[model samples]
Target: GGIPQVIARSYLAWWLGSPAWSPDGSRIAYGVYLEGSPDGDTVQIWTVNPDGTHPRLLVNLGECRAACAEGLAWSPDGSMLAFHSIRGVPAGTRAIYTVRADGSGLRRINRDGLQPSWSPDGSRLAFVRFPTPGGIPGEITHGELLTMASDGSDAIPVLEDVALSPNGLAWNPVG
Candidate 1:
């Protein structure tokens, strides 16, 4: 389609989320949800080449269905993708994740995170991690912005109170 829109849930409808294009603008990583029923949604990772060819499903959430997943963004070098997943909180509990560009070597790189923004230099990525405490899930405990190396090292808290409500996270790259 010229402009994609929500194809509403049916038995096999796939509701696609925002599309994240690669740094070189050669491809896109996006979210897709296969409706289990009219009321059930299963989130997963999907990708399509820039030319809209070779569209493929990268990761299935069935293995991690207890978690909700979305918000896919690519690294500056187009070598990897950074996205978020939630561990079942109705609205969701998020964490950041990464995977190789070819769709191999998937990894859950962080806990309690969202909105992964990779630095232009490809050295680090910034994300928002929520503050969940006392095993209580209803409180709006506030989320803080964070940055970490691509290899999952040297995680640093950079900004706070920057996350938007409802979606719950955001971060901008440092120039």
Candidate 2:
């Protein structure tokens, strides 16, 4: 591998995380944290060219009561993006969402999910669902791994009642 190079940088004091390259490898999608905004620290999705040009905002998850959007995943066809957002206060409800790459058709797929990963064929999405009552309380010791149709239907737990890492989810391309 060649020496690392910085292709993009956040303006002002915003922070960046959750970088996901499009399937075509032409654009990079990531979450930007607008720190100290009047509405609090909110996270929005943005895309930039591989060479760091034509930066565009794809999704603005307005006013996150707590932690907002993260764990962005691009569809196999590079037409859509999936991510998880935690909203509300004290309780901090979590949900999975998807939007077109052009910044439209934003939809919440799952009411309770995190760390979304699209299937290699782009036909399904897998995510983590922590148990209630203790809802992501400290280290996750009990949760379920679920997969659903691309449009968020027929969700079924592939694994349950296990200690799951909130950030661990992926699909084997060969599968």
Error of 1 at 74 (Å): 0.6
Worst 10 residues of 2 by lDDT: 132-141
Which parts of model 1 are misplaced by more than 4 Å?
1-11, 37-41, 63-67, 88-91, 132-141, 161-174
lDDT of each: 0.67, 0.82
Error of 1 at 160 (Å): 3.5
- Checking candidate 1 for backbone clashes, the offending pairs are none
By TM-score, the best candidate is: 2
Give candidate 1's total backbone clashes. 0
| Model 2: pairs clashing at backbone N, Cα or C within 3 Å | none
Q: What is the lDDT of residue 57 in candidate 1?
A: 77
lDDT of 2 by residue, 70-153 (tens): 888999999999988888545578888999999999999888888899999999999888866444524566889999998999
Q: Against the correct fold, how does model 1 do in TM-score?
A: 0.72
